[model samples]
Target: MGDRQDAETFNNLLAAFGMARGKLQLPCVPALKARYVQKVIALANLLEKPLTSAQVEELETAIAQELAKGFQASQHSQLLISFQPNPKSVEQLDFKITCQIASLAEFYEAALKDNFATDSDQLDRLETSVFGKHANARVLDLLPELGDPETTTILDIGAGSGRNALPLARSGYAVDAIELADTFCQQLQQQAKTENLPLSIIQGNILDPLLRPKLNHYALAILSELLVHFRDADQARLALAKACDAVSKSGLVLFNIFLCRPDYQPTIADRQVAQVAQSFFLTPAELESVMDGLPLELVDRHSVFDYERDRLPSSAWPPSPWFINWATGRLLFDLEPPPISLQWLLCRRI
Candidate 1:
């Protein structure tokens, strides 16, 4: 009980759990995962001494990061992981890592099985909750971006559960919702059908050209809260080109994304955790290079939180519980403020 444990001790626990550094992506349910915690506790008991609160907290973060990595490995496409710090239950061993997977697994698995039906669920300790109630405050400002909603067409890429697309449709905009998840697509579809809104649900990756039947058909393309999941600048470049290609000449492409501030270089650990949390970012220069040859021209940039928060009434408030923190880059890393922050970009098609 005298020795304070560290990452070395934690590494030993991971070995005992059969989740070695390279093989942490094993899938299991919460009860089973809870059992893994007990097993690791037993191993820690047999070998290492009781850990200090600081040590336990450090281990908890490591576990959260590792779990996020495993989760990122589990996804078919890029998945935003919400790595929370709170232990699922801290009573048993005073350590937290293995138990953290329970929340993420249950949530993502249910959504994957089309069972996520409530308004929203916390994606992680950071409150990276998905399936929020309100449309983005910024997305609601479409009227000024392009005139006459009835005459203009907008594409909402990665349109999760009609958050933005549905509102746009309700406001009488002819909107095409491009969504990847079947559950989100179904939700948007049913909602649109029920309301008889001018929203069409197109299911698939936004990178696919086939998804867009006609070239330059949309007056605006919005990739809200999407670009962060992209791996690097290459993916961003391609996705931007596609978004630009989908819009008419001089049309607009509106995307909100995290870009690294000057002189802030993310380490390998930071990058991995970001990918796990779906908070991937490119440097502003990298972004500029990516946009160099593309038809899209950056016309405007705004601080996401400041721009949206200032515009919304106090009653509208956050737009969603997760919107404020997530927009400001508070939830991307584990308790550490990321060097990157979100920006609202409005680009015109050249």
Candidate 2:
């Protein structure tokens, strides 16, 4: 009787342990897949028998390290999809893909909730390194020239986390944001209210006519890090046209896009095609063609290279220097409609 009781207890514990180590689906990216596999193996070993609190903590640390390595690898291996030059006129470029904005909202909710598991300082560091310092400063530099303090109302399209909007509002600009992510929109609103900053936030798609009409009243429209989500050229051009229409005469549209050199072609995962997430890379000439009919003038244009010094933290793999070089180097073309590169013409509406 004693032996049987012990056996039953052991079986129950084993079952519970298995349940604790849930199956993990590997990300499609190569580096992520490798990292996830490593984590699974480590976790399996840790769950093989009962562990003290310290031992469990140690295993957790090992898992985190593996994930961080993979994240770094993924960032290093990131590449922009390449665009092939087509003889067709820019207006003729296919632009029919429609995204389900709700899907994006769901993705944001999951991402934000998961981020809470990370340390605040670590998150801040990651944000600064990956997003805040490098690219945003370039965008912020143009704000002074993009609008006048008293006269202009600014529209920040694709205003994720309200990063740009928050600063603009604090600077006393009349700012409004259009964000597609539900959780991000909520967070933005909460932050704005908490900071006592004045900014209007609209949670909706840029393609929605009724919801986006608010954009037409603005003097300056900013589309930072937004255009790359466009999978089709026609769709992107239409969005651009709508943005142009939203601005008043002599109004400015400041935007940036990720483009690949003609020699480099992106794999399916790089373009997010496998997941049906929309994305596209633009060629220099192709971008210019899209801006032909817009009433805006070119102000200045240059290609900004985005380079990363470190790797991403979410990936579970080892870092590869060659992959990092390829992923971190990006050609950012800043344009004002009636197109140019880096910075473009400042055309006055006729």
- Please report the candidate that would top lDDT against the real structure: 1
lDDT of 1: 0.65
lDDT of 2 at 335: 20
For model 1, residues 1-350, the per-residue Cα lDDT tens digits are 33657555666555344321111233322212334444444454553334455654565455546555555444222212222222332322333244223332344446544532343332221111354556766667756868888898888888876767877889888998887766567667777888899999888876665665347899888898888767678878877888888899999889988888788877765665565565778788888898898888888899888887788777667766666676677786544555878898988999
What's the TM-score of each model vs. the native?
Answer: 0.68, 0.55
> Candidate 2 on 1-350: residue-level lDDT in tens?
67777645676545443333133433324323344434544544464433345544554454445434433333222221111212342211111111112244565455544653255444333322223433354456666666566566888888876657877888877788888876567767877788787688888888665665453577777787677556556766777777787777777777766554555444544553222222355655666777778776777554432211222222311122222222223221122221212222233332
Best by TM-score: 1
lDDT (Cα atoms) of all candidates against the true structure? 0.65, 0.52
Off by over 4 Å in 2: 1-102, 116-130, 133-135, 146-148, 263-279, 306-350
Residue pairs with backbone atoms closer than 3 Å in model 1 (clashes): 81-277, 84-125
